[model samples]
Target: MQNRQNQIEPEWTIIKILQWTTSYFKTNGIDSPRSTAEILLAHTLGFKRIDLYLRHDQPLNVGERNLFKSLIRRRISKEPVAYIVGSKEFWSLELVVSKDVLIPRPETECLVEEALLVLDKDKVSAPKRILELGTGSGAIILAMATQNPDQQYFASDISINALAVALNNARHLGLDEKIDLFCGSWVSPLKENNNLFDIIISNPPYIRRGDIKTLQPEINRFEPINALDGGEDGLACIKHIIKNAHKFLNKSGTLLLEIGYDQKKAVDEIIKETGRYAQASFRKDYSGFDRVVCAKKAYD
Candidate 1:
């Protein structure tokens, strides 16, 4: 390996480097080994991910190779790739993220999916009022607003740092003006807000307190605890939103939330307990897990 490094025309090319990194990552127990290698290499080279294939035979200089080695070291230590790169792609829109916010996951996209379904079905007028609770990184609301530009949207978070990342992303996508952002927990900022929304959506923290310790290192270590802890049974945040959502929804307005797969029965009971929602149902993600719960307000 040392001799190959010093060759004037090094034998280590893009394809060769990727092969080595892929095997190395696999040995270290990283999932999607090949893809992880490609993503990190592309970031290190400042090239588009697909560009990697186009330049398969390209050789890196000593400095570039060293940078990739550094990135690999970070990954080996279990640092999340998104945080390493400082952004992640969600709903096909790349959003900035950091330790302050949960990295957007594919399952959360289902929240956006169900929201669009409700919007299209209602065919409500443009500027349909929508609010998202616990809007970490603004993933759900921004994706919804981007696709439905006519909607009036608002999102709130208690952590200023997370909100800052979300704000930057909104500005980057030129959708900043579309969302009214607030710095407060749950419904605090919406006080005195009578029947204000046509739809309320959130992917709030629902991971059980005990279960969090069993999560992947990527989650348990890198992600923020406040954003993951659901208190005792992981329903603390969910229950609060369900109870207050009725007060903020117009007649027949909707409250959509994402919850743990197994929490369906528990959350269902919470919705029923309020008796404020007319219809409560769940939507499965691409993986066929009960990932999102939808509740329609009962007329006052």
Candidate 2:
């Protein structure tokens, strides 16, 4: 039996490898083992995930086995598959990503949806200036700008590397001309210019500093800490953005933000306490967690 098993191991096929790797992933505490198995295997083989099933009986070449093995080990080590593949899909668009930026998550799309909802009220097609701070990889602004190309867009990040990745993605999507990129913290980019925007959107870091170490290993260890930590209360960035957003908004301009589920009440209170906003509201994500905050500046 031992000799037969040893002799047959060299003939592993796509389906065989997938079954073996799926079990391996489960044993290592990885979630969605089968789905992850397919994604990593397909990525290593340069095949679409569905295509992997099509050629299930095809034997892996020596190179393919070596590469797939490396990816499997990385997954076992808790690296996010999106980083391993080097791109992620947001708003139905594929954007390049690296360790320099946070992988755009599906929940952030709610922020985009809310922004578009507000923009729909605009009767004319005139360009409306919009700005996204902490624009990691330019996901939010790029996705919004792509959908509303006529709008003047600007994106900024404090991290040079993050800004570089965002710029690369902007150029990749042919959005460079439409989005004015900058490197600054929060609203400082146009502070001197006295710039005002019709819409301001952000998904700034909202994770509590101490709680970061308690998050999943893939997130706490792999993603950028600066993009995750929001200080002792987890409202540091949110508070700053809220406090300053009104100063940069046009009359009755809108400000939309993606926030942590637990932060809805706290953020809503902050918005109300400010006394600059007309009224603030919250939107829930698919899981029924309060995921976004929508507010408008008072028309003076």
Candidate 3:
């Protein structure tokens, strides 16, 4: 019998490659191996899932076969599919992603949902001012402005590279006119101006430094550490925003934040210490973990 491991050209077909890749992924501890294989193959072919079905029996051209082999090698090395594809979907919007930005997580969608609820209750009208700190890929702000066309949005990020990615997404989504993009740390660009926002939202760095090493290889190896490391306790950025957000928030304005699952107590304490916010509370993610914290500026 031919040795499968030693053979250079294993005479694999497209359908066979899919089966092999799926099994390889499963053996490597990847969850949803079959779905991952389908998505990755579709992405490699520049086709949709249904299209894959249509061409399941089609033979891959030599160039296509080489490309699939390269991608499979990378996948075996534990690279994230989003990074390989150079884009990710968040809040139903396709956003460009790179090593400069953290891939937007589904959990962060909770921040968007909570922000919309606050806007609804506050009755915010047209030309509403909204600020998003650390707007990586502009996912959150773009999603918000797309949903609420009447709102005027502002976004800032500490990394210039991340800002570039975000600006591209905003332009691609036809939201450039609705958002003012800034390049700087959290709340820094807003400090020089007296502009207060009706709503402020952020999904800042909230992962502890030590814990980052323990994360999955796809995250630790590929994602920008600066965007994930939240200092020793994972509350560095959270505390900074909580301390500074009140200054940029309109009276009675709301602040929405995405927090680490174990960070509810620390974040709640920060809000309480600020003495500038009331009705501080947290909402759980779809996983039923406390993931979002919402607070409002104290009514004077």
Candidate 4:
């Protein structure tokens, strides 16, 4: 243990450091200690996680050890692994993330999956138009565009910094030219565009205000509060989107949303209250929790 020191013992190899870090993380009550250790170590060494095993016997020089030590300290402080490593994988595509945006979770991929399914089933021959609200890191829109490149895609976010991250991701994924990016709340900026989209989707903030503080420290402490707080009952953003989406969707257009697991019933009611959709349905994530809401506008 090199506390307040710049150098690790010269004999510390990749395997040795991983073992030590995993134990240290576990003792500190970090979740997925071994996986965290491997990710951080791989990030510090600029190698893929698989490469760590291939180079298990390689010794770390002083600089590499120092960097890994700093990352370990940050982890011990409960900073998220995604922020520390600066990326997360969603829909099998690696996306850039920061504290300015919510880290794309696996559950949200369910929204993308359902939206793609809807698009696939659509009998329309012409290219369809799509819009995504709160497009943090542009994960959903980018994934959708990648799968169906012919569609016109647009995304909006309230935070300019978040939009910047999304733009960076879009550029890296080579979908920048394909997706139009906007910086504004939900449908505000889209109102003047005069574009009625075939599909409207979002993964808005759905955590109740009171519950924000109760989340994991990695989320409550490190991720943006604005991206997590969903007002009094965790339905503020969801309600707003549900109410406004039909205005921008074409006749029979589909609206897809990634919502909190327990929000299905409430969101369903919100959809009904609007009297804007002809049909609405819910989909479960891999964990069998209600995660996405699919609502279709009335043709008449």
Query: Candidate 4: TM-score?
Result: 0.95
> Against the unseen true structure, what C-alpha lDDT does each candidate score?
0.91, 0.92, 0.87, 0.91
Runs with alpha carbons beyond 4 Å of true place in candidate 2: 1-10
Measured over all alpha carbons after superposition, the RMSD of each candidate to the real structure, in angstroms, is: 1.9, 2.4, 3.3, 2.8
After best superposition, candidate 1 residue 221: deviation in angstroms? 0.7
Order of models, best lDDT first: 2, 1, 4, 3
- By TM-score rank, best first, the candidates go 1, 4, 2, 3
Predicted candidate 4 versus true structure: per-residue lDDT over 179-199, tens digit per residue: 999889888876533879999
lDDT of 3 by residue, 192-266 (tens): 338799889999999999999999999999999999999999999999999988898887888999999999998
Please list all clashing residue pairs in model 3, or write none if there are none.
Answer: none
lDDT at position 264, candidate 3: 94
How would you encode candidate 2's per-residue C-alpha lDDT over 1-300 as one tens digit per residue?
989966786678999999999999999899999999999999888999989889988888778999999999899999999999899999988999999999999999999999998898886677899999999999999988889898999888999999999999999999899999889999876773389999999999999999999999999999999999999999999999999889999888999999999998899899999888988989999889999999999876
The window of 10 residues in a row where model 2 has the poorest summed lDDT is 187-196
How do all models score by TM-score? 0.95, 0.95, 0.93, 0.95
Alpha-carbon lDDT of model 3: 0.87
Global CA lDDT computed for model 1: 0.91
